[model samples]
Target: MINDGLTDSKFDQRDGIPDAQKMSRAPTVAIIDIGSNSIKLLVARSSPNNSGIEVLYTHTIETRISSGISQAHPRLSAQAIEAGTRTVTELLRLARAYQPDAVRIVATSAVRDARNGQEFTELIETQTHYRVDILDGPEEARLIARGLATDPELSTLNDYLQIDLGGGSLEVILLQKAQIQQAISLQLGAVRLSEQFLLDREAPIDQNTASAIQTHVRKTLETSIDGSLPSLPVVATGGAIVITRAILAAEDGLTIENRSACMTMQEISQLRQRIGGVPLHDRLAIPALPPARADILPTALLTIEAVLEVANADQLTHSFHNLRYGIAAELLEKR
Candidate 1:
């Protein structure tokens, strides 16, 4: 069984490696991740001769699954189902062109929470010839941990806490020397929080509103986890937080390579405050700020801030590599 409570997976690999582990060359693989806020495709080729995997291509679309999630029930709206299926169909077509040895599609929180999620996945499979694997909470956490572990520098920590902030949920995993000690997925997502408390209002939410959001997040984390966050190296991933790192780098006039550099809470908070004041329309003009992310950025940052308090770390390092990277690595090992 996997950490996210999944017993098994029906995924298949491309034709390069043998069960005996005697392979001359690594296989080329593709993964399509249907996330809450976005759909991403990552194509990579691994070489047994070489220790690293080469990323052939990556693409993403802001499908915004949260928008389609019916607040009243665990169902996706008609529009959402259409958009999600369409995106996956297009991605499948593209992945086929690459002729990867194997291609797999996985859906996360948005799909897992939807009452009609199975219907949506079935539609995509019928239309695109791809099975959609829905990752439960613990499974998602474990895969992320495996992916982040790809970084040699990060894998060496005496203790490491990975907090992946997705559009529909937050997966927090605590690792002791690269082994998972505890993991949990929380429903504290930017899209959900914005819909619940911050939207239908003007830009630059007042401190009062921020306080309420913070209180809600903090109390929720405390209740979910057994105790305070362990003192350890803190790492963050997911689209919004990763992009925020790049945005911060741009604001500081730093080079592109340094965008993923470590950042303190103050820097995060300052960026949050800066964007909070700018209306969505004006935010589009800001460099490195994606138009799709402008409205939800404030709440996204707020969630990170609250998570940082639990981490109790002075700074947070955002990994550009996400779950897709981890999934690929796991497949390579099986090969």
Candidate 2:
């Protein structure tokens, strides 16, 4: 029997365990990631380790609250802001219900870009009794690195290039020998790019728009990457990558293993064409793909393609992990 808060008996009773019993461990924590396109919440049972921690029990909500912020304005819309508050309120209720040892609420990209971000933070805490902290680009990059290194599936890829594309900002981190070597944050993402380049379009991804997106993504990557890039494997995670997999499956019944896999530039370009060609309504009906994400898929694919081009990576692997995993990993590490 494990001597920690849980036991072999508890493990045996898992099938019939009550919620309260499941949450009996100490240092239960919740990591709330308020992103530009999504607001994700994760409450996990944590176990401390010399390196970091372990986590279980996670959830996500693709709220897209910061959708289209780069061009529309550097601030969140009232509707978006209110939606964020509501989402957090619900998460707080869940955290309370679970009675975690602690809870950490954080806002990224959208909040960082918003002029009224501080005000929104106060509102969330005042109304929900949860304090919200905003992480800048560099910090965001580092936390993600730690998360990738700690994940059981990804831990094996000692050398890898990680891309996390969100609503307002995209973070890229490089790892070698299981340690972070370089990282950068780009002002490019699916929501804003879609608003800037495709809000009025209805045709499949055309050469003109695809070229423009590819150019922008390349330029951004060039600016961010300094020195020589290692021949590390490219691993991508986040809503955009997940959606891309769904599109690939739609085209050829391709099954993604939820881990980083090799993808060619030509294959990705063909995928871009196929995804852009589909109507928004058609995207909404695709199984495993979220309806709210229908319109943003094109823009997300564009950014991803550009990143691949700049990295000059031969292939990319997709992971089911995202910011929530990073947040949960950090919370557990703290204990």
Candidate 3:
């Protein structure tokens, strides 16, 4: 019995359960990630061969927690809270249909920073039979590192660092020989940086503002990492990188077969200047980038550039695997 919008007895009745997906020996689970920019759902099951989970379904809702944000008090707007919670409920409904053995919901920076973030999560739990796990920046970084290591190429990089740029924070992790040596989480994120420096206004971002943004990012990275970094390959993850990878892949007449993309430092530098200099609306024309991400793309790219400098990397590689994958893999392993 339940008192909220959903009852325990009717958990899997909203949509007929997809028992077919569970027929496989691999145990199925739904990985739901609620971030500052989007609510991502990955319905998957562990592969019997222990290779990787097979994705049964995927969905993303542009909840955009950074929208209508108040930097002064660090509070998410009522609209943002409502939109995020509603999206969570909807995704839970979809997850239930898959008859997954587990439904895991994790919240990132936006929820972790908000004044009433826990209240919002409680609201979702009251209405739906789902719990949103709030991950700290450092833990988030470790999970992202694990997820990146899932990629065959990323695992082979003995001295590689992976960075995930989300709307709320940036996670930098250093891995050596497939083991995470060090990981740090920085406050610099696409949405927060945009709100404070880059795209706070509707007009095109000016050159001075852009320079200031870069200076700040540079200083932050310089102070965060103490020693001189080795010139190793860097890997990127998150929404902005995903979009950037797709765009770069299209330009090179290449296809994303392995769910990863690579670009040289020269290419990334050129992209930061060429695309970051454009006005807001023009950003919509970029391949695979939706309007929801246009305003923050410039800042996201700048942050990536900063991370590369910190790592002393000359090239960037991006993988589609991220936090959601890491969470799913962890649960499946435990199961």
Which ranges in model 3 have alpha carbons more than 4 Å from their true place? 1-24, 68-72, 252-260
Clashes (N, CA, C under 3 Å) per candidate: 3, 7, 0
Candidate 3 whole-model C-alpha lDDT, 0 to 1: 0.75
The lDDT for every candidate, in the order shown, is: 0.78, 0.72, 0.75
Model 1 C-alpha lDDT versus the unseen true structure: 0.78
Q: Pick the candidate with the highest lDDT.
A: 1
Cα RMSD for predicted model 3: 3.5
User: Using TM-score as the measure, what is the rank order of every candidate, best first?
Assistant: 1, 3, 2
| Cα deviation of 230, candidate 3, in Å | 2.9
Q: List the residue pairs that clash in candidate 2.
A: 37-64, 204-276, 204-277, 205-276, 260-317, 260-318, 261-317
Q: Mind sharing the TM-score for model 2? A: 0.84
lDDT of 3 at 119: 85
